[model samples]
Target: MTLKKGIVYALLIASVVACSEKNGTEHPDTATPVATVIESEKLKFTIDTLTDKLDNPWGMAFLPDGRILVTEKKGEIRIIKDGKLLDEKIENVPAVYDHGQGGLLDIALHPDYTTNGWIYLSYAKPGEGGGGTTIARTKLNGNAFIEFKELFSAQPFVDSEVHFGSRIVFDGKGHIFFSSGERGTKENAQNLGNHLGKVLRLNEDGTVPTDNPFVNKAGAKPEIWSYGHRNPQGLVYNITTGELWDVEHGPKGGDELNKVEAGKNYGWPVITYGINYDGTPITDITKKDGMEQPVWYWVPSIATCGMAQVISDIYPNWKNNFLVGALAQTHISRVEVDNGKYVKHERLLEKVGRVRMVKQGPDGYIYIATQSPGMIVKIVPAN
Candidate 1:
């Protein structure tokens, strides 16, 4: 999967395609394009390797000064400044669990970061029972963290290592949204008493918002924005439409892309298009009365992870589409949707190493973080 310098890829739109639908039905009309190289003057891009020095890079955040902050799964925060990866890691990062699928996971800057200088992080925090997902914030001061504060920690830390559904996004309204996996416990997704397996919303200072759906519901965690999620690793807030979207991993199959709304129940174990990893049926039903269906799902699991929407016009043909990282298949899933409805799909950068995260840089270009070789690459117009 060594990507040569200045390699170009094409974007082709076919009228007929095939894709997996929410009801476990294969849409007869939609087909996922694979290695379809049709040279186009309109939609072409080249991959430029930024740096190949990272270690298991999990998430990335761009600074106003054109620097990049990347988090490695093993608890280091590295910086990419002036087009080169700095040798120094940020100092004073909090201790993370740093075990299977745990560590410093995602990084984000405050909406008012220019004035407040606040940076937020989601990591697996080690505690009494075991390790669980945690969110914290701090201000950066010359390669060191200052005014560091723990914002929230998912309760009842379990001993499991996998399924830490942690990604962070802001709504530009003084609130933060993050995901938490069920800690390998399927039933936890359905339980509201614990923070596991839910999308949480809180104020910038870690206070539960009063208008949250379950604020008054006894026995429910007040920070919960939505419940019944499996392991949502990819989350994004559409500032234009004011919608929150998440993509979570499913077992053997059934990776889901959901339109997350307040208080909605996204069935995980109770109803799934997936089965046990060893090929046993988790359940016979894929739909139930109260549970919501995904906008789209992937059979044979792409291991969907960190995602970003194409909001910038730099890539005119990709405007408003979603670029999602596929770890298992090692490609970027370019998904197109219209008004929350699934429209089409394309597979880009096939065999591109384990694509861990895809983000739109503040400069209106697409940047991708990948593992195996452990590098960051930028996509720009081939023209």
Candidate 2:
């Protein structure tokens, strides 16, 4: 199904109504229902299943040697070498709280990985207070992760298992950044003293950066780089622009794509284009002072998951676009952004199952992780 631009317009109209209902400025939503698929130029490709078996794979990274490392949300790391799924899982992964939304999540490699053999992982650690997002680093040596050390953990871990916004990314510098959800508590997104619903910056060794925006501020968590985000699961740092792009799930609808910047507040419970899952209004206002706006949003959310920039010549026309995995939509949203503006979006890989992660492979093809009989596949030109 192709998504037409008209759907975006109609969604904006409904969003206005949703916002108005919150402020008592309008009665209720009776607008025309928006269509899901936006019509755009479609491409032809053949999906080759590299491996038909992965257990709820969440995130993936391509090794410099063309092998891939995939994270199964069930607290294991599976590796694919020479296009074959290795029978054994990598060892030394810590135990995870694999209930509800908590589990093993995103994984990334150091910029200088070849020299350092360092890899980072974001997982939900079970503790006294249910579970919380945690980041740790380990040495990848001969099919095993050794010398595992905790880098950072969200403070005051809550008892809920939902909204663990745990995606890890390297800033191309020595600094590492990861996101944390509010753990099912909406108001926690606005609290400066907590790590929930915030993007944090830290040195590779888990120390807060001295130049972080919240550093030296009174009563603010010094690790916080940005706040007021919901359950962000997709984070990518654009090497060309040095800008961090993030995508997060919203209640009912209003999934968001934001350009994360230091110290910025991305309105969540305060201002949103979405309402509660029970159809209750979250905020009447979508725009507020001191809150940064999303670059784009989805009404009737796609339940967005993993994301990666498309910069390879293997797909020439897709250069400068982003391949976003849509779990609910079961397609890849090809979003085109130019000069800090979202130009348009198209859907790809229709009927490929619920896409969990999308990444550009070292060989320049597009690799995807899918759920429901979990599998790892790649898209190559239909020659």
Candidate 3:
């Protein structure tokens, strides 16, 4: 579907009505939408099938017992045990709106999970006219997630379902960071007061981090660590560098891999390499003076999702690189860096449909979430 500017204008009109219903002030438009195409060599991957298939599984996290937990888009979570899919799904998940891109989003374990027994989740909590992305915590009991409670929710929720931006990861220091999507509102990306389109910092239990970038600012979301993003679904705090990294979706092109920094704006709606899906220009410049440019970006989007830092001590071939999952591109992208600069990007698993999430397993191999009639595949270097 080629998204024309007129269509984008119409979408914005509807968005304004949705926001007005909730009594938010209307702001001027920020940037135009754009569309671009990325074409690269066809790639290949090895798929180690899990025991069970899932329905649009959006997130994956391994429990200490080596059981795999995957969250489905339709609000269900399944447990995979011993390379086999368990037929019974854990119940009592909170109700989700599931409109466009919103549903059960991401899952992560607490750093002290063995002692705390906490499993964190991000989802779209259904509400009156629409919903907003929410970060919550719960405990796992057998196959079920129990004692679930909302730790934080985007306020003045809009009417659209796209761009839920629900990725969660805990830093080494026990602080949590949650990604908030720009809910079909381009102008909101520049609004410091709004919760949408920002990387937020909070304590493990969901209290605002006093050291957050905007904690003392008036009208700014108190938890905002960095601002100006579209839909940031990939977030990981690199253990080696102690830095947070995120990859986000743009309109039709302009996928980005960013080193998420404290207080800096990431330059979304205001500046993008993407245009409206209809092929119009988005921003005048790819780099602005004050706004931070991406550490690396795709002129033609890779439809990037989850990513993880690859660490290898014995194999030593793929160390210190980033492995990113691609939805539109249908591959696991390996990004290599040298001397704090992006060196190269290679694709793995070109025909595997959607590689939703990527993570390094405890046993020293990569695991991926194949969303669809979902398949969880373990990636081992062909030896």
Candidate 4:
């Protein structure tokens, strides 16, 4: 019996040697790091182009049918299916300013989108002399927006072609949070009466929430959630924690990623870590009393745009990383977060051109939108 057991042990040792030396290159059995370099001989990627069905697709929300609803800056929404851009655009899109960086911007579906049928849009509305970012809600009826009306507007904006903080997201409390750009007027961000450069919490019906900090004030606007931001292009709510996070573009530097909270003030122009385009100083102090500092900042500026939390069920290994779209760098930034702190930046797909937005699609894929006859691209894990 002992001799039979020895024979079995010898066979087990021989199997281990075969796995390590014979077939190891093709199927590695030992433990590998999470970011382990793929062996080129054992791996291959199928680069299937999906742009034939895309037209400068801006922001995309994957529909239940596996097709995508994409926005074109020229004020059109097109449908894409099976790696092809549809020529037929959904009609009844609202009129937009379409000047400079303005046009129909972000689109977000209601949290209970399947039942409510409500979709939100952010656009630059043509004002008397200038424009303001207009937030509106509409129901999609047979591929067109219907029953549409303005829910809110960023106020006191000038005629400048810059600074429209049109980013919006749904908070966990069934309320909407949107940002208003500084509009080249720095001081307007600190004012509570007007909405410029402010993160606002609003009811679904467009009225201000009663629990807002300024609701009891004599002349203050009740929708104001947090004040003093620049052109905040990125905003999202963490699904796991329900906490709101945003990233904003600063002057030459001082690009910021902040945790937006109620009633707090984020000092933008008055206490920035950035400088003017011509190297002039914008602010000296990076932090001051009674003013909130950014949770993370880019000293040289990444020209940050849209931000998305990498949920685990979708991208298993990239769970905590907030994918930041970079316009200036023309790359997607994988911002890894560790216990509410910024850890590292992993540049992904640098050759794809200027990334406009990063979003986790409902189809369990990472959707990245690019500008200039914009196109939407999907990121899938290599098998």
Largest lDDT belongs to which candidate?
1
| Per-prediction TM-score to the true structure, in the order listed | 0.90, 0.88, 0.86, 0.85
What lDDT score goes with residue 106 in model 2? 89
Query: Pick by TM-score: which candidate is best?
Result: 1
Give lDDT tens digits, candidate 1, residues 348-373: 87766688899998899999898864
Taking every candidate in turn, the Cα RMSD to the unseen true structure, in Å, is: 9.1, 11.5, 12.7, 12.8
Off by over 4 Å in 4: 1-49, 52-57
lDDT of 2 by residue, 1-383 (tens): 12222212222112111111223343211222222332336444545556655789998877788778899988999988877778778888899999887899988888898888888999999999789899999987777889999988998698897999998888887899899998988898999999999989999889988999989999999999999999998888877789998899988899998999999999988999999989989888999999999999999999888888888888787887888888887778899898889999987756566888887766788888888536677766654
Cα-based lDDT at residue 347, candidate 1: 85
lDDT of residue 316 for candidate 4: 69
Stretches off by above 4 angstroms in model 1 are 1-42
lDDT of every model, 2 decimals: 0.86, 0.81, 0.77, 0.73
lDDT of 2: 0.81
Error of 1 at 212 (Å): 0.5
lDDT accuracy of residue 225 in candidate 1: 96
Displacement of residue 134 (Cα, Å) in model 2 is: 0.5
